[model samples]
Target: MLNYLGLPIAASEHAGEIDHMISLVHWLMLLMFVGWGLFFIYVLFRFRKGANPRADYVGAKGKLSKGTEIAIVVAEVVLLVGYAIPAWARRVQQFPAESEATVVRVIAEQFAWNIHYPGADGRFGRTDINRVSSENPIGLDRTDPDAKDDLTTINQLTLPVDRPVLVHLSSKDVIHSFGLFEMRVKQDAVPGLDMPVWFIPNRIGDYEIACSQLCGLGHYRMRGFINVKSEADYRAFLAEEAKFLTQ
Candidate 1:
């Protein structure tokens, strides 16, 4: 079950329904190759000099090979409408909400990622590009009173295990990508629009996050870590982050 990339077969979120869709695509391609191969082999064997020694003069005279044509059309319809359409629809649907869900915001820059978690208030701080400076990673709007309480962290993100988490992603300069290779989730973080992604971590572990788009010379260095911890550990991490913001 090794993949073409020589990677071991996935058995976790890395191999979720998305991976299954990829497998189905490969299988369909293999079927087409086999069918075409057999057709060529049959032609070579049946029409060789030793067998007929002459081309069929009526092969192209509107012979109406209706059965083969109909079968090809049917196979195409099944693959498109039956398999591909449903899988795409499911992925585009919004993630389900649970009673206990966490919200996190991710902002992408040229060569870094900034993560923001709302404090106990559950409201994102007001942000203004005009007030942007080196100190304010998220460019909080000082004039807006709501910006006073937002907590911001850089380079690292943390999540609680088993809780439904929603991530709102955006890019500051150019188009970027928020992708978790292990989680099997990736989406474009466009500049003007905020893209939302959601997932629940079933296990406790650290995962890698990368910007899949070519943003700048340092695009390859735009990387971060996501630590999914137990409920207690997640609270502790949030407390520590709050301390940094208050100071």
Candidate 2:
């Protein structure tokens, strides 16, 4: 269903549910279109001038039209309450445990994404706006012991396959959207708000991250990459980053 629907390759385990929801909505729309089109055609032929030269004083009325209208309303209500709301609730409200999932902070700026890892200590180092510089965009307090072990990368995110990854998303300036098509994850990165998105990538590959919202003049360049790797490769990446941090 996914491949034939023109959707991107969904690498995340939970993406199938998203695709199902999309399919359901499209099917509903198609059904409505066909039903209405046929009704219009029938009306044009039934009320043709040749059949009735003089217009009837009373308009044609029947239970079928009322029933169709009621049915459409019921279907819409069911779709909203039973399907769409539940799907959104699961994505936003039902978050996985931080201890069980790999967590990272994704900070957005104009035309760039800053990826911050908590290192071995599993703690984000202190950041100060006053210390902000061209080289230190996040303004990490390097004097702090925790800051010494923290790892930061530019537009690069790495995670292990078969495990949930929680991304704490925020922005420094205006609002930006973080969209990963394959994982079916899209969330707004608003300034002064730390939103979270969790997903489990079942396949090992690189996926594109696009900003669905137009934030600035360079919004087209606001892109990132997610690299889902095997467990061994994930560990190796950690080890290599740790060495770089220590040096």
Candidate 3:
């Protein structure tokens, strides 16, 4: 059903659940559309001018109409309370521990994404606005002890499959939306605010990170990539980035 609906492949842990809700919503809409269309046809045929010359002021009334209305309301309530709220709560309130998850910071700017990874020490380096430049987009204070092994990349985010990935998202300029369609994750990256988004990638593949918001003239070009690899390959990627730190 999801494929028929033109949805992308579900790659994350919660992507299936998200797609299920979407399917349910669409099913409900289809039911309503068919039911209403039949009702309209019935009304037109049952009350034609030729059949009933006299005008009837009081509209038709029946248990079927009332029952249908109640059923529709109940379906909507079930979707909201049973599926939407719980799914939303799990995404927002329940977060895996940092020690058990792969954590990274994604800073959004005009036409680019800066991905920062805490190196061997597992501690993020200090950043300052004054130190920001073309060479250092995230303003990493390498003089700080924790900053010594920090690694930064432009438009590239790599993570290990089958583990929770926690991304601390922020915007440098205008608001941008971090959209991973395959993972069914979309969050607004607002300036001066740190938004945390987490998901577990179960598929080992490459996915595109799109800026869903119309942020600026270059918004169309503000795209990134997420590479989900095995645990060993993921560590190797970090090691390769670390080697560049010394250079």
Candidate 4:
């Protein structure tokens, strides 16, 4: 169903539900389009100038018309209250514990995504705005003990398949949207807000991370990559990054 709609593959645990909701929305839209088209044709013929030379002052007082309008409103409300709100609540309220999930920080800047990993210590270091530079975009205080082992990557996110990923999302400058189409995840990275987005990747593959919002002049080229690997390979990636940090 997702492929038919030109959507990316469903790769996350909640992707199926998200796809189902999308399909339902499309079905409703199709029904509405057809229904309205038929109504329009009926109106054109039923109120032709040849049939009724005089115009009626009171328009559309029929029960059928009122009933159809009510039905459409009810359908929209059901989608919002039943599916959308529950899905949103589950994502925001039922986050996996930080100890159990793969925790990372995703900071969005003008045209880049700064991926930050807590490394072996599993603790994020202090970041000062004054310490920010072209060389060190995230402003990690390397002198701090926790910052020593932290790893930072540019526009690259690697995760192990079948594990819940907890991302502390923020923005350095303007608002940016962190979007992983395959995961059915899109969250805003606001400048002053630290938002949490969690998803469990069930597939091991490469995907794209797009900035869905029109953020800046360079927004067209603001993109990132997501590499979902096996558990063993994921560990090896961490080891390689750790070694690079030492140098």
Best candidate, TM-score: 3
**lDDT against true structure, model 2:** 0.89
TM-score of each: 0.79, 0.93, 0.96, 0.95
RMSD of each: 3.8, 1.9, 1.5, 1.5
lDDT of 3 by residue, 107-196 (tens): 999989999998889999999999999999999999999999999999999999999999999999989999999889999999999999
Better of 1 and 2 by TM-score: 2
Candidate 4 lDDT, tens digit per residue, 1-247?
Answer: 3465777888899998898899889999999999889989998999999999999878788898899899999999999999999999999999999999999999999999999999999999888898999999999999899898999999999999999999999999999999999999999999989999999999999999999999999999999999999999999999998998867
- Candidate 1 segments whose C-alpha is farther than 4 A from its true place: 1-15, 45-83, 97-100, 142-145
Worst 10 residues of 2 by lDDT: 1-10
> Considering summed lDDT, which 10 consecutive residues are worst modelled in model 4?
1-10
Shift of residue 77 alpha carbon in model 3, Å: 0.5
Error of 3 at 42 (Å): 1.6
Error of 4 at 130 (Å): 2.1
TM-score of 1: 0.79
Question: Each prediction's Cα lDDT score?
Answer: 0.77, 0.89, 0.94, 0.94
Q: Any runs in candidate 2 off by more than 4 Å, and if so which?
A: 54-60
